[model samples]
Target: MLKYQQIALEIEKHIEENELQQGDKLPVLETLMAQFNVSKSTITKSLDLLEKKGVVFQVRGSGIFVRRHKRRGYVSLLSNQGFKKDLKDFHVTSKVIEMDVRKPTQEAADNLNIGLHDDVYFIKRVRYVNGQTLCLEESFYNKSIITYLNNEIVSESIFHYIKEALGLKVGFSDMYLHVDKLNQEEAAYLGLKEGAPKLTVETIFHLTNGQPFDFSKVTYNYEQSQFFIQANNELL
Candidate 1:
């Protein structure tokens, strides 16, 4: 699975480098096989994945060509259970970009309420909805809280692991939404042009014991997604 993902990424890189363009035909399977040094099955699987993502389209008796995708729909962050539970129409998937314990940036340290010297598990993932890239999320977890995190755990739901494996009860989370511009890393992962406008959500999660254990920032492709918020009347 990981190998196929790497091949898909390399194909995306080719598109980014202008080696491919919208409506431009793709190279033959043999060409791709030699280019990536992979088997025929691997190349076919890679193209199939890209096709599902609306990155390329196939023609009967003809070659594959790039397709300009018009990504649509909305994903909710209104619940603490995560987007998968909240989304009704989309099948969500995650690609783990990196996972390692590292010194926290000042912003991450402050949000997770940890000291500068404290090391945290930094996890980065690119999330997709029915094959269309939606967002890139970077999460910082207190090592003392989720001490067993790895790439495999990240490919699944971290919230699930926190509650089920670690036996931690989530109390509440504070979320701040903002309109931001994409940075280079985010732009590349989401396949967006540099400095594209995005909707960003920053969240801090706390345990029942009042310990803040997780801090995450998720950036969404604004054109492909929307956010809905509900407000109820309360006595002041």
Candidate 2:
């Protein structure tokens, strides 16, 4: 992890451990600098990241404050942290439906930018949030890039494994979202009727070097899922 990221986590932990409520002021910059033994620039970067994550907000000429908005079923569309990390306050579990190594399909090959003969790990799983079915995911990881996987890893967070275990930097993902009806198998997994409308997300995940490593299609139980994205004022 980067210095700023570690500092950010520390600040978040401080908020949780101290039971800081919404609108409660966080430590001043000078205080945090002394607490973390880091430079002003480092603290600023960490605060910036926390602001982006909606954990805190800044008011010009005022100290930082917590912004603990209660958003049940809400997920950040811009985050690549995956469900487990994103929903850390909630209980998240995965049921692995299928895991296998196989030759890439044409769609997977094209999306992952690998050759037809290259191997890929095919994963099918259902995710539950707080013990309720949330989403059904089918994913392909390029064997050459991802290197390895097992039931234990897939049962938790693959993104965590790719970063913490493999020591790979996860870059941006290109995601497309649309509403579609679920097929029979997908509906069954999500405990919905066949042809039920679902919010489908297709994503191509890349590494920091700009190499595509994973492609996935996720169908969410519409009533159980909500997503949001943070945008800068400059975008408006």
Candidate 3:
């Protein structure tokens, strides 16, 4: 583990052991100085690292205190190593409402590898987290494999649907992240004010059978959400 990570774990242990609580001051510099057996610079770096990760907050002179707890479990499909996550953990409700065929726009055509006016299927959804607006995801699938979308059995995560229900192999996807000013319509869907800043992630998902199958664009508030990645030395 990285030194900072080890420090983080130590602090977490302290917190778990009730040495710290919400709004409680951490040990003073002189106290930590003796406990960690490290230089002041190293200790400071570790505290700063914790502060940046939202695990701790520093008061002007009172010292650091526990702030937010780590999110705990996060899994991303592209990395392909974590346990199969149950979407229920997100505390979000997702409904895939409409799926229809439409002609691709010039930009959509380029993203999905379809002709400018070629037929494509549009999958629209509204996702909520903890009963609050979270994201609006619009997925476009290549017409060939999109026959599955014609069914009404759309579930929580589209990736899971394609892989399990249809017995399709999924792997390798490209993602693009960007920030944009939200419009009134999108903000309404997300329960945010108009012109709010939002982070958008667009992904082109490909299947292991040598085909690019899905393109999706999702918009959500960055201030309200985050992402996590886990690594293992063991080969996946």
Candidate 4:
């Protein structure tokens, strides 16, 4: 195994041995680097992978801590831009499971203002925390606006690529949040029992010009994460 993966496994073993628990702080980066005889970057990557799997979390200036399974709650959406980066306290990682160009469903076509016969980039990604799947996301992007995308960028941050590489300004998005029972595919991805309750969010993203460019549905493991909305103004 890679050094980083090895380190991640060691950390997980530490947890499994009951040496760490939720609210327990992890060793500092320097300490871990020295203990593992790995470079700082390798240690960081291992911790990052663990964080993505919901194993541990970081506090900005404080330090990393073991994440209790029940104590974990992450906001599904932050703003109109789409997909909050509030995971600063955690090591976030993702895997692009599948990517394809295909025709959209009627709803997806309408939301993205594309034709049902026109092609869209259909991307399926699983976000992990502490080696466990946290969210299963299937996103459809307008081929015209997004232009080009690959698995690498998909696994990282599509939003960042959209802004930095494509120079497209993301305007805002409309989201519908609800609870539903997990389907077969979602259950398989999240390793949840069939029919388990799932926290779901459907989103439609628009560009600065008010043109819709992306549509996505995210299914989260309710047992591992929680979601909430904060509003500054009342809706009329």
Clashes of 2: 0
Q: List, residue by residue over 132-211, the lDDT tens digit for candidate 2.
A: 89999999999998899999999987888899999998878899899989889888899999998999999999998999
Task: Using lDDT as the measure, name the better of candidate 1 and candidate 3.
Answer: 1
List TM-score per model, in order. Answer: 0.66, 0.87, 0.60, 0.66
Q: How would you encode candidate 4's per-residue C-alpha lDDT over 86-199 as one tens digit per residue?
A: 445566678888899989999899889989998899999888776767799999999988889998888777888998899998887888889989989899999998999998
- The total of clashing pairs for model 3 equals 0
- Candidate 4 off by > 4 Å: 1-73, 80-84, 234-236
lDDT of 1 by residue, 1-236 (tens): 37877998788778857856578988878888998999989888888777765577777678878864333344445566667854646788999988999988999899888998898999999998888888899999999788889778899889999999999999888899899788898889999988999888999999998888999999998766875543322311
Error of 2 at 108 (Å): 1.8
Question: Candidate 2 overall Cα lDDT vs. reference?
Answer: 0.89
10 residues in a row with least lDDT, candidate 1: 227-236
Q: What residue runs in model 2 are displaced by over 4 Å at the alpha carbon?
A: 19-22, 86-90
Tens digit of per-residue lDDT, candidate 3, span 162-216: 7678877786788898998999888877878889998888888788765677788
**Greater-TM-score candidate between 2 and 3:** 2
Clashing pairs in 3: none
Q: Give the TM-score of candidate 3.
A: 0.60
Q: Provide the global lDDT of candidate 1 against the true structure.
A: 0.82
Candidate 2 clash pair list: none
